[model samples]
Target: MSKTVFITGTSSGIGRETALYFSENRWNVIATMRHPESRKTGLEGRKNIDVIHLDVLDPDSIQQAVTHALTTYGSIDAVVNNAGYAAFGPFEASTPEAVRRQFHTNVEGLMDVTRALIPVFRRQGHGTIVNVTSMAGRMTFPLYSLYNSTKWAVEGFSEAVAFELRPFNIKVKIIEPGIINTSFYDRSKDVLSTKEITAYDTLVEKIIRYEEGNIKKGKFSPPSVVARTIYKAATDGSWKLRYHTGKYSGTILGLRRVLPERTFIGMMRYLTLR
Candidate 1:
């Protein structure tokens, strides 16, 4: 029997590609998203894929999605937690509501889904959980403090869970991708400052201009690259805890490990500004 995988945020980007990649390879895919009736409707036509509704913020939706997957496939061999968004701006500019929303979707929502899956995996004696994090989790970037915080939380959560789940044969993996070509950048929410801090306006404007240029240039790796890496982590029995995808993800992470903090920060400042 072919193995089954449940992936969240399948409406676009990495999640969509991962679902398609696995389905093409003969794995049963439970592709889920917040709004299931949109352009992703055609995904249901795949030979072994089921597109379902899943709003990570809604516990009921999460439970329903899990139930449907379990009933259809009998077992969920892997789960790709890919439902998240980036909230970009200066930390001082971010409102409490914006910060809450970021954590709600990126951190709390992920844990909620993991909680719902733990018992099922335990019973089956094996499973894999892949959390889609980012290189920002390893190193900070200007104007992305809130987004980085959430990914930082994901990194810590995945690391801790890996140790806790090892005895149960439940493997946990973190896929840290560098700036991927995705709607994540284009569709990201920007929190505007309620009160202007004139001191940082120039810096903020420069960062915003840089972000817009990156989106227009579309220089990041294709989502398929991330999808392939996620597939390997889900299927390979190597037990690696983290997989870095995209051009600079691995190199940046490696530099953080070796370079002094001040030097690393200086290099990042120059790269982002220059």
Candidate 2:
């Protein structure tokens, strides 16, 4: 029998690609997003795909979507918690509300969705939880302190839960992707307003320019790269905890692991502080 996988944030990017990938590979896909009406990723009418409305910030909606998937698909074998937003700016420039929204969507929201599936998976005796974290989760960058906090929390959370869920045969898989060519650089951006603090302006501008240059040069990988990695994590049947995907993730993470802390930070500074 073909397995079923529930995915969030399917309106675009990695989530959409992953949904399509799984559907093409003969898996039932619950492709969910805030507005399923849009059909932006064009999953409608596709084989083995069900579009769902899910706002990660809404707990009720999370449960509702989970219920819908289970009722429609009969069983869910894996869930991809890809519904998250990013907030970028200096930490000092971040507002209380911004921080709350950031953590609520990326951290709390992911937790809520996962919590909903735990019981279902427990009943089934096996399941996979795939979290799409970033390379920033392990390594920091300028002007991404708020975003960094959420991803780091996810890494820690996933790691702790992975150990806890081992007895139940539940798997927690983390996907750490480097910058991918997604609206994350555009539509999904939540840049903190820096009008009050002019101190970090020069550094922030430098970093933005450096990043824009990379995007212009096509250095980032596409969403399909991440989708492929996610598919591997879900179907590979390994208890592996982390799968680094997308461009430059392995290189950057490997360097951070072997290099001294100060040296790694220095290298990061050199890249954007120019």
Candidate 3:
């Protein structure tokens, strides 16, 4: 009786790796993406994997994917909400529409998918929900204010829901990873600053350039690292409410918790300038 897990955003990166890893470990995987017809390179002919169409933005699509997974596997033991995008720029430079898009995909979309799946889990009497938040949710960084805000909302939402769902034996967990070697930084949406704010153009450009360079240098951990952490959280019985999955995430988060506010801000500023 292998458990079934439904994962969103399987088009690439962490979602794809998690699907592959769980399938390899003898679990049924419902791998979903927004554009199922896209000519993607991963998840080709995996025996235990079923690729499905799921657009988190659309309630109908979410329902269809959940129904399909239940029919294919007979039951779903976990749902991983991994489908989201990143928007990088100064908060003042970001447009209202850009902020809405971030909340739509990261916050509202996640809630929609979870709400769609809750009834199914309730019927089954036991299940898990794993949210893929970032270290940015806990700490602020330059040019990522809105993106961080969305993740922070996710962190809060997941925490509050965990308490409510405990009576039903439904577990909620948050996976917080530091910068990973994903296309997130490269493919993030950009909201151009108004020309009126011309004074900060050079500073903003330098920050953006540095971020791009860091991503290209491949200093972040592989997607498999996150995939493994997610797999453990999904299957293991001793599930904690939160997991810090990358090398630096725990250390930095711990520092933020214990260090003085001014000291933490100073360290962050030094890192940003570096």
Query: Estimated TM-score per prediction?
Result: 0.95, 0.98, 0.94
> Which candidate number has the best TM-score?
2
Compose the digit string of candidate 3's lDDT tens values, residues 1-274.
Answer: 9989999998888998999999999989999997878747478577898888998888899999988988888899999999988787667777889888889999999999999888888999999999999888889888778888999999999999999888889999999998787767665455556577776677688787777776778668888999999988987876498888875788899999999999998999887766
Of candidate 2, the 10-residue stretch with the lowest lDDT total is 38-47
Model 2 alpha-carbon miss at residue 12, Å: 0.7
Which candidate number would show the highest lDDT if scored against the true structure?
A: 2
Q: How many residue pairs clash in each candidate?
A: 0, 0, 0
Task: TM-score for candidate 2, please give it.
Answer: 0.98
Question: How much is 254 displaced in model 3, in angstroms?
Answer: 1.3
TM-score of decoy 3? 0.94
Give the per-residue lDDT of model 2 (tens digit) for 189-250. 89899999999899888988988999989999999999999999999999999999989999
Better of 1 and 3 by TM-score: 1
* Per-model RMSD to reference: 1.6, 0.9, 1.6
Arrange candidates by lDDT, highest first: which order? Answer: 2, 1, 3
Candidate 1: Cα lDDT at 183? 79
Q: Candidate 2, 266: how far from true, in Å? A: 0.8
| Residue-by-residue lDDT tens digits, candidate 1, 125-164 | 9999999999988899898888899999999999998899
